[model samples]
Target: MLNKSEISFSFVFSIIVMAELICGSVESLSTYHYFTKPSILISLIFFFWKHAQHLDAKTKWLTLLALLFSLLGDVFLMFVNASANYFISGLLAFLLAHIMYVLVFLRKKKNSKKVLPFTALLLIYAATLFYFLKAGLGDLLIPVIVYMGIILLMAITAFLRQGNVTKNSFILVFLGALFFITSDSLLALNKFYEPLPFSNISIMLTYSIAQLFIVFGLLKQS
Candidate 1:
């Protein structure tokens, strides 16, 4: 059950996410936007930290670390124009974040009897996406492929946790992984393939919701 403070924080969090979406959609991807971008994840970090006190030490650390890396990714991506290295840095940060998420989710039972079908489905989707994106990936092929692998692993682990965690919690985290992958897919499409209409809005919308669901799902584990 949620307390008053948690409820209030959630309301405020929703407002902040909405503001970020609106601002991200309207503003050009300039230095100013970069400076403002970190605010979203920073707020989420606080949200996670505040609620994480109830979690076990290992879970708490993993959750916080994931959020920290995500925050770093947001900051680094902001400076992608200043230096291409920043894009690499951002990629690495998010990669680490996904790794942390996979580790956290995998703490549950590894061999679930019910998850095989979902696992096969996700694997097929990942393979199809890689096939489509491979031609355009060129020099960045290896890193992107590795990133995709980790995220698919993360999503699979989330689904496999069904019996290990609350039903609501599992659903939330699984959807979070789904949206995270969707956001990243849109990002790759825009950068390596043709630009999608309203890519910024779509990517950030899904990305922000992904983080929120993941954070809250983990919080529910406590």
Candidate 2:
């Protein structure tokens, strides 16, 4: 049973998640596509700030840095519509943020055995990426390869370093990263190649879920 403050904070976080989804939908429908990422990033900051007292000093700082990098990723992606460079910049920022998360979680835990599954999973994903690229996926190869590598590394790092953190929370973040990867992969597939059915809806769905899970995981950790 949650106290009044806990319940209140949860409600506020839910609203932020809802707002992110709504903004994403509107962006997909309207001409102002740039608003979605920034809007969600702002909501994430607010969500973290609202629950700041519950988090440790290190977690709080890392969360702030992650949000900052996320904002940068959004800004770069929003403006660089011509080439993959902008996307790469955004990817790098996000990669760094993910590394921060891995570090934070590792500091919380030190068991190497817990991460074995994650390492195996990463290897499989890497193999798939290599196969896809070798099969001549065209311009889609670079972005997919980079994104997959970064995300898999993050997951494996977190898995290998699980310490004091709750299993549920770690699972939540791991799943969130998975959804984020799915959303971005779908977007890239649609943009560079053929437009798949439900591409827009899929992106919004996975993106919203990814944010929700990540925020919830952070809150739970705190």
Question: Evaluated with TM-score, which candidate comes out highest?
Answer: 1
lDDT of each: 0.84, 0.67
**Per-residue lDDT for 180-216 in model 1, tens only?**
9999999988888788999888898899889988988
Clashes of 1: 0
lDDT of 1 at 119: 78
- The 10-residue segment of model 1 with minimum total lDDT is 27-36
Ten-residue segment with the worst summed lDDT in candidate 2?
27-36
Task: Itemize residue pairs with steric clashes in candidate 2.
Answer: 108-164, 109-163
TM for candidate 1 is: 0.92
Q: Could you tell me the TM-score of candidate 2?
A: 0.75
Off by over 4 Å in 1: 1-6, 27-32
lDDT of 1: 0.84
Give the count of colliding residue pairs in each prediction: 0, 2
